[model samples]
Target: MTFTTRFAPSPTGPLHLGHAYSALLAYDMARAANGVFHLRIDDIDQSRARPEWEAQIFDDLSWLGLSWPSPVLRQSDRVPRYRDALKTLWDQGLLYPCSCSRADIRAAASAPQEGAPLHGPDGLVYPGTCRPASPPSGPMPDAVMRLDMARALARLTHPLCFHETGAGPDGTTGEIHPLDMLQTVGDVVLARRDMGASYHLSVVIDDADQAITHVIRGRDLFDATQIHVLLQRLLNQPTPAYHHHRLIRDDTGKRLAKRDDARAIATYRAEGCTQADIRMKIGL
Candidate 1:
């Protein structure tokens, strides 16, 4: 199949060095393979996503000489699509409403499970606190909806796996597998009852809709890939190959963020940093 990849950045702040590295890396791979590179704005968090930041993203990517094949896909405009996916998962009995507050989950997780560490992605492995309270019929509650991760794991007939192209111990693409969802990363939120949709659901739906074949981003998200893989299986959607590149960090060794405007792409450019300088600074 023709390779297709994307660089999806949240427009909560200006594009920083780390953002540039990820976008450039994905663009390079797409170009090298004669594939398609798509740009997507993960602006689902409407509360923080600003139009100015979104506009700046387009300017910065163009400045770096990167180009995508089509118009960018903004998550904010794709709520209906995400909602549809949630409805499907709920219909299949793969999801349940979680009303436990943030503190409640922490309290339940205070007691550890034997050799299980008592915690996972969604905080405290849920303890099934709300499981007993789940409604018997009709639509799920307005509270956050979480997929039955433990249930998802048991349904896998064989150990699930995905190939990661252009990334491995030796900087080469390799296939990794047998992702044990429950043991490592616990139940992740699929769609927060109040947030409209969770990162996991929005991302998978957008990628599939954009026909992204390879997902190239940061290593920080490598673990999260397991959750995405499981969701793909549950939804019977095609799984894309992944390439999680190393992250660009500041002298303090912390991963860059939008708040680090001192290292923002536009800032660097204003300071007379050339395209090659950026390439060197980010090790692209």
Candidate 2:
């Protein structure tokens, strides 16, 4: 099969150095291999996503001399596809409604190191308080729907693994594997019974639809790959080769964030920073 890769970014915030690094790395890999590089806007979080941010994403990528094939895929326009997969998981008995509040989860997790804490890009790990007590016959909760991790794990055969294709710090190729989905990542959300879809669900569907054969992204999401792998298995989707690259950090050595607007690609452009400057800063 021809090599295919993608860079997916949410439109809730401006692209930053981190976004530039990921986009450039994927772009270079595709260019070097004479492969296809695609772009997708992860605009499923309708609450925070805005038109201006989406426009900025396109502007920023263009400024950096990157281009995706055809019209870009937008998640907001693909809710039906995500919903279909979600219903499939729910029908398979792999998903359950969650009713626990933040306070409730805190109280449950306070019992000490037992269940893995659930988290998202924002950072507070969710405690699976209702996972055990979840109702079988009621309507799904209004808050969230979580995957049944134990049930999902029971179906796996060999341990899961993914290979990193790009060159590394030690000049070695990297492969990650022997992943245990239950212990490390735990039961993650598939949707807010309130929201349209979760990141894991939407991403797998989109990647498959886009025919993405390789996933090139930051190392920070390496742990989350287990969750995506599990979803791929449950949904009977192909698991692509994954390249988790190094993250871009600040002077303090902390990973850059969307909230760090000072590093936003728009800011850099405003200050007349050249595409070459971004390329050099990210070591592309």
Cα displacement (angstroms), candidate 1, residue 16, comes to 0.9
TM-score of predicted structure 1: 0.90
Candidate 1 minimal-lDDT segment of 10 residues:
169-178
Error of 1 at 179 (Å): 8.5
The residue ranges of model 2 lying beyond 4 angstroms of the native Cα positions read 112-127, 132-143, 166-180
Q: Highest TM-score, which number?
A: 1
lDDT of 1 by residue, 215-242 (tens): 9988777767777877887878889989
Which residue pairs show collisions in model 2?
A: 118-126
lDDT of 2 by residue, 87-191 (tens): 777777777777877777766766566454555432445555667654355444444788887776766786655566654444444343433445445667788
**CA error at residue 227 for candidate 2, angstroms:** 0.8
Q: What residue runs in model 1 are displaced by over 4 Å at the alpha carbon? A: 112-124, 133-136, 166-180
